[model samples]
Target: MTAPTTMPKFSKENSERRRIAKQARRLSLRVLIVCGAAETEKQYLEGVKGLYRNPAVAVKIKTRDKSPLEVVRYAAAFSKSDKDDFDEVWAVFDVDEFDIAEAVREAAKSNVNVAVSNPCFEFWLLLHFVNRRGHLNSYKQANALLCKHLRDYDKAQLDFANFQDKIDIACARAKDIDETREKPYANPSSGMWRVIGQISPGSHA
Candidate 1:
């Protein structure tokens, strides 16, 4: 009869190191953000990631110049295909002339989070400076309002530095609007604060 093979034993120090490594991996969170715009949203989110610089949180952004519904679908598919890779998946888009009902429904079905800025994303940026309750008719109108605060505001480029310190204030303002409004995605409202809260949990606003 063959002698029984003895199992190699791990030292206590080695076992402790293994346990710590597993714990660290468990603590880390990986996030994927799918944007409907090609530039501005990506720029702003990259800035948020840079500001936090949280070692345990990893953020990845993908841009698709598609409709909000399509963007949400893509994010959902990607999440499904690589479910193990990301702890959470988010879809960010504007309600600019597009019927966002389907997109919102899809996000809910796929368990994807959303950051929607009604009329335009600039409306969210505008909140960082001022809390205006007026309805925004179009992207141009929101951009114009944002320009009042960020004189050099441009859709092609974004300066995260301008909005960095004002994050808390912006979140508070957004929450106030959300609380008072009957519709969640009402004009001049933004769900961006929700995303910010997740990426930067320390945000009090």
Candidate 2:
């Protein structure tokens, strides 16, 4: 037999330096979505990556139907690279009637603040609407009152199920996007990043 091939060893200091470099590039308030399937997560991952950089994600189970703790622990470990690298942690998973909220609360209690996007499947699509054009915080209850807005604007046929699409349609129609109304600079007053908090009621962890 040929000589056994050994794994390349990395010095601890070198590994730590590389990790610090990566942490510097990552954003604060890192989000982790525990989507149900690989294919489904991949679809939403692509959409999220289109907007946010390197937003992490995971699956609903800990491992092969095991407890959720396994995965939560993994996520927690991955996030603690430098301890101060991120400000908040988001554990997003579909409401599976399995006390997911409690699980998330426990998982996040030790390290940082945590939030969850209930009905996680749609959380992916929700981001497409709420966070892309604007942060969700600027428009609270918009999802609930979307039909009313449409009616008020003489577009009564529209519905909340299609609310995000309609908003995007409106954005496209406005062509010149009134910076005064829908700014994209992360400044709620100027850009389209104002939809962070107001639009998503389905996300609570």
Candidate with the greatest TM-score versus the true structure: 1
Scored against the true structure, residue 183 in model 2 reaches a CA lDDT of: 25
For all candidates in order, the CA lDDT equals: 0.87, 0.37
Local accuracy of candidate 1 as per-residue lDDT tens digits, 1-205:
9999999987999999999987875777878899999999999999999988776776788888899999999998887787457888999999999999999998999989989999889988998999888988898888888888888887788888899999999989988998899988999899898887777855321
Scanning candidate 1 in windows of ten residues, the lowest lDDT window is: 196-205
For candidate 2, write residues 1-205 as lDDT tens digits.
8999999998999999999877754622334333233443334333333433323321121111223454455556656753444444333333333455455666657552322233233322333344433433322333333324333322222123444344443333222333445322221211112222212223222
Tell me the TM-score of model 1: 0.85
Clash counts for all predictions = 0, 24
Cα deviation of 104, candidate 2, in Å: 2.9
**Distance from true location, Cα of 101 in model 1, Å:** 0.5
